[model samples]
Target: MDLHKLYHVHDFHSRNFLDTYFSSKPDTPFSHETLMYPMEKFHNAFSTGDIKGEVLIDISLGPIIHHLYSAQEYFRDIILLKPTDHCIIEVKKWINSRTGAFDWSHASTFVTEMAGKSDQCEEKEIGLRSAITHVVKYDPNQENVTAPIELPQADCLVLWGVLDVISKDLDDFVGNFRRFSKLLKPGRCLMYYGALNGSFFVVGGERFHIVKYNESNLRSILSDEGYVIRHLEVSQRIIESDLIDFDSVLFCTAYKEQKI
Candidate 1:
């Protein structure tokens, strides 16, 4: 068992620690290669060709273009649906707080640097044409948005960080998906991440909780809502997680059932 596979879902403490652990455990599932396994799956999914006219939706777009481009390159077209620009502001503040310079930024700067690029990409290119589309407002309460914005009929959608906000109340949240599925074409796919266990703590006045649910339960809920499980990845946090807090995480993908 390789630890890389585990990292695909749960992150580890540190690269050095991971290297040492793997060096010692020739046969341990927690090997270094096993730790980074999830990334490979992610990369593979983004690298492999999928059907044409399929769209890829990424929920949180902070300035990570490499991964976005990878997905776009793999899927042909990609759209980023950000719940709020507040996330970008918060990210800016976080960077300023650590770096002591409001003059520098992350994703915003990346966007500026990559200005005028198209949002579409080709297989030979490993980058997004325009890279990201900011969803200024997200009405999780509704299936489609109230604003005059449109998303392509995504064959695949990446539900990255929105699960915590959307899954707050399972019944309502899942119901929202029921209505929202109409916005997508038949057989659209969604990829997402969630915590299997944990508590939501107050961070910057936003209500959040670590989503802890087993695959069986998650599948049951989504299945009842006309969704089917494609893949389930369980992961833990590495020592230096980008997340301010939390030690572990899990991710999964589900596809909307094609209409009868």
Candidate 2:
């Protein structure tokens, strides 16, 4: 079966994913793993000041913007690249503050409190909304993912659970990574956050495929692609849920050393 075809047929539900993984449940192992862990990782990685940049290109798995709350403080402009219109529309809903948008106040509040500015939760959301300047569609199979538009080589590129979802195998993963690298300046940073050893995730009662790879596989791929790993962190799964099967989560920051 063509995985891409399955993807379109199932049609990823942005709201379903958000509610399933990022609900405002306090102290549940699921929330701790999916929500708090990623937020904390982003906050810690960006706080180092090594990832600061003028423009940040975000190619994530869905319309999720919770991870970008910390990044908005460092990057002047953010461009979101989505593979599906469903994801793009969901993003615009939040950005435009339209009706029925996924509520992200809980995420913003968590991020603000982490930074010791609990009073500025609304301010954080506003900053992130202002920073996201573009939400464009992209095809990972294309030589130029955002063809004809000719986006500038960004100072930083952030990938959150995108490669594994789009990649069918190791070769596909390598090719996709190379294509995404073209959007970043040489020696610039790439922040990656993805599930480790994940095979599939359920959304809206439909199962979607994901490439299964371990930390070593990821490290080797990055190295072969001329990326120098600066920081890498792995968190073990704390909750067992039938909605998804993954052993752990991996988050890392690497610099592209050689232009492709």
Instruction: Name model 1 segments beyond 4 Å from true.
Output: 1-38, 51-54, 61-66, 88-126, 133-136, 201-207, 237-248
Looking at model 1, residue 209 earns an lDDT score of: 46
User: Among these predicted structures, which one has the highest lDDT?
Assistant: 2
Model 2 / residue 145 / CA error / Å: 0.5
Q: Please list the residue runs of candidate 2 whose C-alpha ends up more than 4 Å from where it truly belongs after superposition.
A: 1-10, 26-29, 258-260
True lDDT of residue 260, candidate 1:
92
Q: What local distance difference test score does each model get?
A: 0.46, 0.87
Q: Clash totals for all models, in order?
A: 25, 0
Show the lowest summed lDDT stretch of 10 residues, model 2. 1-10
> What clash pairs does model 2 have?
none
Cand. 2 TM to true fold: 0.94
Candidate 1 per-residue lDDT, tens place, 28-100, comes to 3332222233334455455445423456665532222233434544555565554445444433342234453
RMSD of 1: 10.8
